[model samples]
Target: MSDFTREPFPDRIFEDLGGAFSMGCIGGFVTNFFKGMKYSSTKMEMLSSGMLFARRAAPSLGTSFALWGGTFSCFDCLMAKLRGKEDHWNAIFSGTATGGLLAIRGGLKTSLKSAMVGGILLTIIESVSIGINRKTIQTPRQQFKEYQRFVQMSENQDKKSRSELKLSEFK
Candidate 1:
């Protein structure tokens, strides 16, 4: 009861859920509206069809996004608690759990496949993020040191070229 009561982190779970839902709704509305326009011939028909499609699709898309964001965040929190650390493993496990849980109604095989796909996708995303951050993050002092090293190297190269030219001229 005590463990359950205390949240490990005060996070953006609700925010993520709501944000994803809103984005999904917007995407759904735009996509369906354009689709409707494509199928309709007259201007009035296009507007009618677009409105109809948007009204029908927006909520459904938003709900799907809300489910995914909420479930993923919940699983991520659970995994972080179990692992006792916030890391890529948490994301991978959460992705697997969310996918499996979401696909449970389909069948066991489908759930398993979904789980694998989710885990792999999360893993790849995490790995790429790590790679990209490796060279991008530098403190001001580190940046200055790198700059100084570059200047030193340039000066040494200039000096070497000047000396080589002098030697060649003497010969």
Candidate 2:
């Protein structure tokens, strides 16, 4: 049977915590690069400072993402469940919004060097995430297709078993 239990509150909170800190880490790296390029140390400070700010902001963003993700996840899960399948695109928009917020928070450019550095950091985060997830999770279409194939295989096996049993009477 499929598990339909409400996702644990702690775990959802944990995502928020992790997301903020991870974004902060990205922020720090970006800040360091800016510092190297002769950008004002103030900008670097802001980026590092943004991490702490992010920690404070995390609960809000996390709760928002979770609520949004949960609501959508439930709806998609229902549609897929009733249709005898699963929908994997459910949380995508929610995740994108979350990522965009992370990118914008400390990655904005007030000047040329800072802009270049910020843009680079944002690109790195986005590209790396896509690459990693691509290696990990199946795309929604792929997931749905796999589920359909499994169902078909099960049905075919049932048909084969039934046919063999019916023919056994002649043996």
Q: Return the top candidate by lDDT.
A: 1
Summarize candidate 1's per-residue lDDT along 127-167 as a digit string, tens digits: 99878777788879999999999999999999999999999
Residues forming the 10-long window of minimal summed lDDT in candidate 2:
85-94
Report the C-alpha displacement of residue 32, candidate 1, in angstroms. Answer: 0.9
Off by over 4 Å in 2: 1-119, 134-140, 169-171
Candidate with the greatest TM-score versus the true structure: 1
| Candidate 1 positional error at 103, Å | 0.3
**What is candidate 2's lDDT per residue for 12-128, written digit by digit as tens?**
445545555555555554554445445335664655565555445555555554554444344444444456643333234334333444445455443334434534554566577
Off by over 4 Å in 1: 1-11, 139-141, 144-171
The alpha-carbon RMSD values of the candidates against the true structure, listed in the order shown, are 8.7, 13.8
- What are the lDDT figures for the candidates, one per model? 0.86, 0.53
